[model samples]
Target: MHVPDGFINAPVSAAAGLAAAGAVAVSLRGARRELDDRTAPLAGLVAAFIFAVQMLNFPVAAGTSGHLLGGALAAILVGPHTGVLCISVVLLMQGVLFADGGLTALGVNITVMGAVTVLVAYGLFRGLVKVLPRSRRSVTVASFVASLVSVPAAAAAFTAIYAIGGTTDVPLSKVLTAMVGVHVLIGIGEAVITTATVGAVIAVRPDLVYGARGLAAPLKLRVGGELVDATPAPAPVEPVAARSTKKVWITGLATALVLAGFVSFYASASPDGLEKVAADQGIDKKAEEHAAADSPLADYGVSGLTDARLSGGLAGTIGVGGTVLVGTGVFWAVRRRRAGAPAPAERETV
Candidate 1:
């Protein structure tokens, strides 16, 4: 959920911003271990895709709607560290370019939506993956459950944050009730999207999915009349085989473009979970004007295009393209840095 300005006080927003900045810094390092030629570029596509899907808000209640948060989906596809960075990038893009989320409240959104959701979802996904059968179905099931829980957990996090730095004098209990209630419904939508997307990706390329790496079922083997678990050996590391990431990157970018450029125009215009909760709980009484509201591309519609559908479609396309290019550049640099200094002996011998 995109938190607009004035919901939280300035000090809390700054504090949250600092925390988000720190998490992003740490994720950059962690992504190095998680990223490679294949996954790095794919990571950028993931960000753009998340950005695109978020535009399409599916109806949750009669008047309320929700969209893909992408925390669980990202973590299941990539890794938790990278997932946080993905959502953070999307939130930042929306805040600065589209006047969607508040620039001042960027930290709040990152903390509640990015950090909290990813942490909870990834932790749950890992735990389930360890206990459940090592099958694609199990992975999908785990992803669904993880995604279901993450949304309410994020809502709880926002409740606590609002209790501390809320601009209005709304009742904490009411805020919690409304926030959790609507978001729980939103979580189901998130679960379906996360499970379906992760399952589809795993079906196509399990090797590229970070969460499914080295995952294998332990077959039972009889030895000396006693049953034993025979775990499969880890696959050998092959450097050259990792170079196929370019295709995945291109595919993800293309998918994002198609969704944002065309599908986003059909997105529901109803208020999202956060907006509904805020309006219900009086938390939005002090909503501040966005600093970037005057931008040409503000509000996910082109400035000159009078046709609502055409204007929104053009804005979505540009956003997807910009995010892909920027995110791809960042992730490519990360992969290059990680690909440094192939064996020193090999270098010296060469």
Candidate 2:
């Protein structure tokens, strides 16, 4: 959940800010190992896709809606470090440009929604995959369960953060129950979306999926009295991004565009779990005005756009484009850093 400004005291908020900054710094370094020439751009596309799907909030309860947190999905498709960066980039964009989250609460959003979700979901996913059958179905199942758990975990994390820094006098027990209760329902939706998306990608280009790698090795078979590898010996190394990579990338981008540009119009208009909880629990009483409240694209609508649908559509499109551009740039830089000093090191001319 995107914590608005003033929900937490300045001291706790500042502490969260420092924690988020450190986490991001570590992720940047770790992502260098995760992203390559091929996945670097894919990472950007993943961020864009997450941004798009998050716009399509689905109704969870009677008046509570939920959207893709993208942490589990991204961690499954890419790697955990990159996944954290992906959500962070989306949060940054939403905060600065769309006023969806508070600038002051950026740290809280990143810590809860980005760092905690990615770490917890990815860890569970890895553990499950190790014990489950080594098949695509297992991967999808693991993804679903990991995503399902991650939502409530995030809810608990937010509750903890609030307990430490909440501006209101509400009892922590009530807040914990309500947050986890609604979010568990939201987690179901998260599981469905994560499973379906990961299943689709695994069906097509499993190589493009970071977590699915090594899971689809050539099937071994019995020969005579012994088992043998079915595939021939490997050839010279090639770039990870092949023709199929382009196809999958393009397809994913197109799907994201369709979802954000048109499908989002039908999304539920009800408040999300966190918003509803905040209102019901009086956690939002001291919510201050967003720093970007006066921005032209505030609230996911253009300033001069007359048609609500058209304005929202344009905003979503722009958000996707912006997230993709910025995310790609960041990932590309990380990748470049990974392939450091591309040229061979020169020998000393002694």
Report the number of the highest-TM-score candidate: 2
What residue pairs clash in candidate 1, if any at all? none
What TM-score fits each model? 0.93, 0.94
lDDT of 1 by residue, 89-147 (tens): 88888999999999999999999889999999999999999999888888889999999
What is the C-alpha local distance difference test score of candidate 2? 0.91
**Tens digit of per-residue lDDT, candidate 2, span 1-350:** 78899899999999999999999999999998898878999999999999999999999889899998889999989899999999999999999999988899999999999999999999999999999888888899999999999999999999999999999999899999999999999999999999999999888878778888887546688999888988867767765445446887788888888898889989999999999999999999999999999999999899999999999898989999999999999999999987874444442432
Candidate lDDT scores, in order, read 0.89, 0.91
Which pairs clash (backbone N, Cα, C closer than 3 Å) in model 2?
A: none
Worst 10-residue lDDT window, candidate 2: 341-350
Global lDDT of model 1: 0.89
Clashes of each: 0, 0
